[model samples]
Target: VSHEFKTPINAIEGYTMLLQGEELSPDQEEYVEKILFNTQRLSGLVGNILLLSKLENQNIPMKKTEYRLDEQIRQAFLSLETKWTEKEIGFQVELEEVKYTANEGLFMHIWINLLDNAIKFSPSKGTITMFLKQEQDSVKFILEDEGPGIEDDVKSRIFDKFYQVDGSHKAEGNGLGLALVKRIVDSAGGTIKAENREYGGCRFVIELPKQKDEII
Candidate 1:
């Protein structure tokens, strides 16, 4: 599999590097950004697919490390600042001082994918609210977006691979984002669910155990 995929993947990397070294218009930069994002995503896609296979067979490696969960999420927000700012979107973040033990690098994907969704379907000038805190025996995270909520019928299958909501934003994603999010959450012995917010828009909630190792 590696030999079969090497040539084309190298070509993608070469062209991407060329594109990055040049000056570009905002539109062209956006195009390059998408290309870069997808290229990186494609590289990880194979591993994630394999991880899915591991998940089915009940083999997942949990390399836990201590890190500030609040700082990581704040970095996710900062990383995608341009997208939300362009839409005049506002963020209401309430992150209590909380530390979590998990795969430090891979967990960032959870926040990035979810925040990208919130920014994508959000109305102009909308406010996206987020909260992360440790609660008793579990840590909780919640994100709410001011966009059209998911339809009840499609809600059940939203996390399925290659399933995109049938609407205007249908063309926006390849549908693996949420699926990957679910994979990481599940692998870490956590729970994640989606639902419609009471007033309007979408809500995603996640919970994870607070305790890790007794030796620590």
Candidate 2:
């Protein structure tokens, strides 16, 4: 089902990219960008929907692998170079060496989705900070962004599927990102929460069981 949707969306995005490279008036260029953006969004939405259904139905296996946690987070950050660089965003990453046994591919999505969310809401020339440490038998990860913090009322529902932050121009996403994050965390026998940072913006914390512990 996702492939059926993504095939056409990919073609539209490819054509839109070609249009972007062509000479055009400012207005035409803006229109091309809009087309490309929407097409890409549609592609992501399709994949997220499929992933959500798979997780919800327990169709995925409980396979686990031992991997370097810090490296995984760093790679996720590098993968989004263009997105952060476009906004002149700087990262202060402080990760400790830690290894954990888990489904590597599944956990990768958590970092990527969270980083993408942080970058999307970050201000121009802002700084994003990431911290990772082993707490007793578990690994703790934190990501802080410099953007508008969630409102008190809407904060509780941020992880609800299709729930976007209300009354903000920056709340334009399809809102599946955090919901997917929550589902993935549950599958890993972990807990994730969000809070408004005292300084500004939002902070996300994810705590996972020790490598020796049993996984769901």
State the TM-score for model 1.
0.81
| Candidate 2, superposed: residue stretches over 4 Å from native | 1-3, 14-33, 167-172, 213-216
Scanning candidate 2 in windows of ten residues, the lowest lDDT window is 166-175
Tens digit of per-residue lDDT, candidate 1, span 49-68: 66566656767666778888
lDDT of 2 by residue, 16-119 (tens): 99897788999999899888887887888898998888999999897988788899999999999999999999989899988788888889989999999899
How many clashes (backbone N, Cα, C below 3 Å) per candidate? 0, 0
Query: For every candidate structure, what is the RMSD over all alpha carbons to the true structure, in angstroms?
Result: 3.7, 3.1
Candidate 2: residue pairs that collide: none
How does model 1 fare in lDDT?
A: 0.84
For candidate 1, the C-alpha RMSD (Å) to the true structure equals: 3.7
Highest TM-score against the true fold, candidate: 2
